[model samples]
Target: MPFINLKTLLRRESVGGALLVVAALVALIWANSPWAGGYEAFRSFTVILPVHAWAADGLLAIFFFVVGNELKQEFVRGELRHPRRAVLPIVASVCGAVVPALIFAVITFGHGDAAGGWGIPMATDIAFAVSVLAVVGRGLPPALRTFLLTLAIVDDLVAIMVIAVFYSAGLAWAPLLGAVAGLALFGWLQQGPMRRGPLRQGPLTRGPLRRGPLRRGPLRGLPQRQLPMKIVLVPLAVLVWTLMHESGIHATIAGVALGLLMRTSTLPGETISPSDRAEHLIRPWTTAVILPIFALTSAGVTVTGAGNLLASPAAIGILAGLIVGKIVGIFGGAWCTTRFTRAELHPDLTWPDIFGIAQLAGIGFTVSLLIAELSYPNDLGLLESAKAAVLLASGIAATLATVTLTLRAARHRRRAPDPAG
Candidate 1:
């Protein structure tokens, strides 16, 4: 491969999954080291909110923004454009979430306080899951990634709803109304006079900048363009995010709302839609910088009370939910949906592929840690223990998925038509 292509593959591909693990490992080591006090102090230090809070709310919101964009694109022109294809992920995502919550609740039963953390394992960290697939799944059907993406997106939506409804400290109506109005405006602006397909929008459709020879002016040589972001876009986005935060709505929803509302059709004179362009521009940054930073801050759990963490109902619930509940829920839901409904697995895939993907879903890291932070704000010991368990479960899930997917890919490779023919 050329240098640029190789560089891009590293930055944009499954290598990020490995990077996430490295960052978390660094944090875990630091937190449990002789300098553990430094980690705690840094974690607790605040500007407006503590370091962990900013990571969970602010950094993770950026991550979800990309997810929202993916969700909209899939709905617009990808696998989700058809009802038959969409049903599998939608059902499986729900079952995947519900089963984990049920398991967590059952495990934590008789302890009402610990049971509140039931929401922790109900999420799948798509970044980790997709990246893991990309890394170890060389000869696997491409459709498997699509299936994983669709399932993860649906479950992400479910997770967002859970945070908004079940986890919010208290709902404040006025700011929420303002947030709704702001989001509406954003959608309207992006969808401006657009139709089924690409149409004219910018300078090309208007004034002197329309097809012509170079005009004589100081700015004549420059390509004519709009700068709405500098003028209104960024401020409007900040205002919406602030309103959502003020409304006690788990501010990440603002990212999802804006992302879902993005117009996915290209405008005339553009090669790609605005959403794709934004994702292309932002995804690498989020994957490389934002996710690792969030991991560093949130995964820094001291292991002084290892025995206590093992015994804690909250921690045990998280472990059981991700390790067991996710696989059973996701795979079972998928199997039933395919068996009973008209929908079927892609021709390129098989049950083993689905099983591997289901196992990947068990790697709940980013959103899981965020929910853990939300679920036990008052109980520091419980919070750390839960976070520790999330790290542990995610690590184990990643290992299991690697073994399964690697074997599946090897089998597929062995069965391939010989290029020597």
Candidate 2:
């Protein structure tokens, strides 16, 4: 397919963010309105599959797939390819996750049930953060965006590991093993073509896939060696996803596995990489549809009373962890990394810029809400409170970060030389 321009991609993401906010607002209003009973009934009335489950497990899988592809491309061909350059963001991301969790734990201490929501604050919603940065920090260095992207990617990697290791329930050994085998096969298929397919002898038999063939005029007689992606890769992806779901792990892991296993090279005739192709194909849907539906479903928090929301320890912990903890953790972690190691901040970024970006990272919306649900499955009250806190903290963080970044942007604009001069 055609490659999307970078500016266009960023613009789309900004629109996606706006849509997310609108969807969540609609949900919140519908849930809290006098017709709240109707909204509740609609959410509760399940058909073949619950709308809630479809949004969380099914739609979010596409989001994770896009995320996985991004991480793979970054490591293989983008910013995270170099260890020296990646070190600062990696360190900052780790500290960013750890501090929030620790703060949540400390605040919710002694409340055994509430403490489980620690992971709620550990995620940085990339869509919201990126949207805010792109809009308000237009005059900022591109490297700042790179830093935030890398940091958020690493933060997501940590969140995924936590979900896999901590949140999964009811271990089923047989399906787990099957998932492993399926993932292995998926990886092998990407590296080399299926033995029975036409691809068995052509591209894979020769060397790494190359761009030259596709760029050159189509050869009339060259045997098509690559298996049709729909016929082979799609089914394998479905099987792997099913196996993972049955294994009591989050099915989204399948998307991540498939994405990381994708091949980025072509054997002389290919112009697009499997990873990039998957991204281009899947990203538009995830951003525009899946995420908005998810926000609509998961963000419907009916505020019974101010006291109820304020009294919940889980909510308070999440609020503090996101607002206070993220700023301290990310900025402090960056500071410590620079102090101990030779790693330096981007040349164009000042301390205030880092502080603003750290605040932006705290605007955790979609993933945080998902984690809140998973954190407390039985307790509807706790779930609503946690959701409320996420919304509250995210709003505060967005406003504060926008103000901070806008000031910095204005300073840059004023200092810029006039063309007329």
Candidate 3:
């Protein structure tokens, strides 16, 4: 019954995803309509600020700040904290990333300029994937959710590196230095005197302490907690954004790095859970605002003719890389790791279940779109084509995975002899 409330919000994510799908369709139709010019204008239309730099830089910086918060939450307490528990998904994520990139690189071999798009297929859009899991009914387990979340976080880390290393334009050392400085500042905030000060005061305690030595009270050994470090780190992250933008690296990378560095774990003895604090602060803004806006802006596409779709190499490469690469990499990596390490699969799941989940991992819409934007900022035609292919591939992958998993689970239930008999 307690989860009934949680289920409502979860259901809304799925519903919101459906709306996004509709919006993408509308954008496509509008782009191909007589009002095509209007569609283009909508994308290019800027919200101007009195300060040009703020308009150009500030909005995206907020986007990255949200990203930083998510990354911190994951590393501090989410999935990445326990290395053994994390190994399966981490391995799968690496394989998922490396194999898709290699596949994309091989396909786009001659087009050196477009090869930077290799990262396009490396990410798993957690929102979309979670939505699919929700739709796949009761076949999936909580452990699978944990597994996928961890895998996606690692995938994002890899994707961020790919953007920083491969997609960045001519590097300006100054901005890179500034980004590094920002990260250092975040790290210091996590471990330095500031974090310790709150912990020293002990865990939050209500009411006044009793007088005398007893005044130390029931909370005498209460661990200290840090003030929300984001107060300081946020401004610094914005500065990093400016520098990264100036240096020609995509500013989002700064957000990802700052997130990873600043999300230090509170020790078991600590009063407050750092991961809880970070997630509580970050998840809503990122989910509700940053990601959706990014989707709306980047997912716009025009599929005017079949010829345009067929001719676009980036589109073909991305779709194939995601649909094919994710299934192969996830299933193969999971199988190999389990066999070699003899690790136990989740009790309720089997090989078929793992394979089905792997198939769902192909839903790469969000990260794929982001990469498409970075890869083809000047080539709207290529970007649109890629967007279309990503949507189509993701649809097929989700459908097939959902159907297969549902049937498999049903069969599993049916085959078990009734214990009552």
Candidate 4:
């Protein structure tokens, strides 16, 4: 099947990401304008659902769904399928998350309640990071893009674990039970005879199945057949949201778990036709619609007193951590691992080239912003300061990465031998 090429879609994400930056700027300007109050009101305006349950749950659940889809894809077909192939990126990502959290914890150590915000810098915004790589246009290799993406996915997984473990407030046994039941039901549906028909014949044939022509069955394309996966999963996801709201765990944790469950992939290294109908359906929805909306909603922030940002501790912590942490964690970790393990760097890339890509990894705007909001919703003043820091750090990192890589590319071009010679 001819599926939409991910490389092409990723290129489009670069363009969309530029638009998001512009939109964010417009939102900031409008929020601080004379009509600033109106901007706040608009953002705060509630979109009520028939089910009182969902309105209280907020948009974080949707965010988790997208996260789940991405995670599933990576595990199924992308970077994480082969443990050996995935090891270096995973190590770098873990270090990237851990060092920043440790830094934040140390800074906010004495303040018990405030220290909960330590998870704020743990996520990497793949869109912004990829966009920077696109601009850099040289020195960076395609493998670098894959490596960054893999690391970002790993970073997200760690962030989810942190949110689930540390950020949860109280435990409500009943609702938690309901969530478990939903997951079990969803699991049964996935493993049942319904999914076996096409999937058995489909390209993925590594675990307990063989490649062969699909068998026709009553389970073909029944939404009811697929119902348990989405139906129980989504509502239980809502239940998790409600439980978290009551339990004091961040509501977003529920979203991430549900997202992890939703993503799927084909078997390893199989050249499945891109034209597979399911892939066509899921890919566009995820890339274009779900991801962009999440970025738009999450990235808006009003930076009223920019000067305060320079002096704010939260601002300083976030900026320093992302700009310093990402580059150090990624290149440093990769370099150390390759040295010890003797793993080959992607053929076209050098240490300096990888360093430039590492700089791009500092583009943590979207995820950083979301985590900040979850970490500190009541403190708008602090939030604004943190947002400013994230923006500035990401911008500087992206600029450095882009300029250095482009120059390196130009130098390489100048030295290339002429075919006519």
Candidate 5:
């Protein structure tokens, strides 16, 4: 429940972003090199699932789980606990998504089947955006970072909704029902009746058996000892995910569902809630292993025909949406919020700071690639073009953000009194 300051969070995300870039670069090199055929073979080779599917479905589920946990914690106990504090970023996030999709649609409408790829530009890669901010806007206020975090979190939640509702295959009723039941049970188990007795202190201590005044009904019969969370929770989570996967809804939805349903609070004696423990255990794995693996497999767009790829309608639409739409949508949304509501930008920040952050939000690397693959599943050329566009747009966005932020930082430094004074 301790507050992690913004700088610390940005530092952690920057590390992940660096790893992601490295992995993606390696993939691009390997895919375009003479070893391209071997890379394709390895990715297509199936165990229980194709290697690419494992990276996208299995590993990415862990990443989404962490995302869900963070969002839930924010809503339940962090900056988003208050509605007034949360509304600006939520509005900004919505506009950010809507404008990009609209731009993509308009740009690709006349092209064959390219309009379906509208969702590709709507996502903001939180890691990459935060990394850019950390590197170039170190002098910026922490509140700016918080705003970016909130915006990204809401953006991710919207992206998940789009994937679940738009991208999923036709539903299989039986497994769908099973997935629902499993999710409900998971929620119930985590919401186990609140402890009644004077809560025990410390992580390891067991609660007293005798009921106290604080003790309530229904939970009275339960033993004071903590439930075997691993034995009960893990299997149920797996069951839900499997059912969800078989139901033709992306399996990652199950991860988000379970994470949102998890308890953010535990009894006084408990060391950590399921949400905290799970995030702590898997965060490093997701950052260092899962995401890198995904990048290695998914970012390998063979750019043999670089000019053709860049000139493709899909690529043009994606680039336009990311580079132009994101900045307009995000900044416009924030400007409108300030104009119409009591919400305001941080005292230390200027319009230029918001613009820079908006530019960085265009770095829609991971989620954009996922949406691209889903959008053009049957068209290899289109998929490759879309992926290349994402890389290009992300790079351009990062560069613009870096320049703008550095100038802004330098301006602030100049206006400050010298330390020798």
Candidate 6:
């Protein structure tokens, strides 16, 4: 195969996903090697705060921020605009989350304190899933990818709610209120100084709305005065993150809150909305740096006893939840929704396609690792087993999905109609 250009490769979602994997592999190896002591020391070394916590609390928030923006756009002007197209993903996300938690609970039922990790496998890492799809999903129905994206976004919101309610420390009402106020201000600023032209008349309605989080030229359509507005937004955003952190909720929730409040529709002269620009500006950093750092710090598990970890309930629960539970949960949920409810799958797609996509949904790396940390804050041994289980399960999920989607793609191509007639 001919090599692609460096710039183009860097821009691909697969590249960032590859980096995250490589970082985790390096960390895992380092943690298990003879230099394990040094790895532990480095992970423990801090500058007035925990380095790993920064990756979890601060860096991951940037990823969630872009996700928040994507969710806003989809709900307002994208696939989520039509109620018919929206029903499947919404229902699937809820069922997908619930089933995994239930699986984890069943496995860890009698194990004291291990049940806290029931939330670890309840979420999907869309970044990894999308990359896997992009590489091997050629000739498949376009609806499959759309379904995955929509389902993941809604799934993220569900996961965020779980974290806020289950994982947070004692609530501090004053700071929580301050975070809410700051988010409101951020939303107000997103409105911009420009007024909306008549909705049904003119360029505002006719302009094509660009999608995706990491597109370049985000500032191309904005006015010069709007450039300086970042100064104010930056400080305000930090204030919100800080307040949310102090409020005993996860700080990443602040990013999601601010993202949801962004204005999705473009103003009179602008081609891009404030939400789009923010995503464009922040997505690259989140992908190239934040995710890799998070994987490095969180994925380092020193596997001293593989047999014991395999026997452990928390580990067994995570594996079962991601690999087995996700498949049964999401695919079963999709089937029941279309079968029982008025909702229908796209005419172009098949049940098998949904099954494959559900398999991909099990690659719950970044968020699962974070939840593992939160689930076993004081128990190093349990945390290690859980982290190992997550990595192993995600790899299995990715491999299975790849094989399933590749076969499906071949079948899709074979059935495609020719236009020569």
Q: Encode model 5's per-residue lDDT on 311-331: one tens digit a residue.
A: 787888889888999999999
For all candidates in order, the CA lDDT equals 0.80, 0.77, 0.65, 0.61, 0.78, 0.79
Superposition TM-score, candidate 6 onto the true structure: 0.81
**Global local distance difference test of model 3:** 0.65
* Overall local distance difference test of candidate 2: 0.77
Candidate 2 per-residue lDDT over residues 287-321, each given as its tens digit: 67877787788667766533566788899998898
How does each model score on TM-score? 0.84, 0.81, 0.70, 0.69, 0.80, 0.81
TM-score of 3: 0.70
The local lDDT score (0 to 100) that residue 250 gets in candidate 4 is 43
Best by TM-score: 1
Question: Which 10-residue window in model 4 sums to the lowest lDDT?
Answer: 221-230
Mark the regions of model 6 whose C-alpha exceeds 4 Å error after superposition. 1-8, 138-142, 193-227, 377-381, 412-421
Q: How many residue pairs clash (N, CA or C atoms closer than 3 angstroms) in each of the candidate models, in the order given?
A: 0, 7, 6, 14, 2, 0
lDDT of 1 by residue, 324-343 (tens): 89999999998999889898
Question: Candidate 1: what lDDT?
Answer: 0.80
Two-way TM-score contest, 5 vs 6, winner? 6
RMSD of 6: 7.4
Residue range 254-273, candidate 6, lDDT tens digits: 87777778888876546777
Stretches of model 3 off by over 4 angstroms after superposition: 1-26, 47-81, 105-120, 134-139, 195-230, 241-247, 258-274, 308-315, 342-349, 366-387, 404-421
In model 6, the Cα lDDT at residue 200 comes to 28
Using lDDT as the measure, which candidate wins?
1
Clashing pairs in 3: 198-224, 198-225, 199-224, 199-225, 200-224, 202-222
Clash tally for model 6: 0
Model 5 alpha-carbon drift over 4 Å, by segment = 1-11, 130-146, 163-169, 193-223, 344-350, 377-380, 405-421
- How far is 344's C-alpha from truth in model 5 (Å)? 4.1
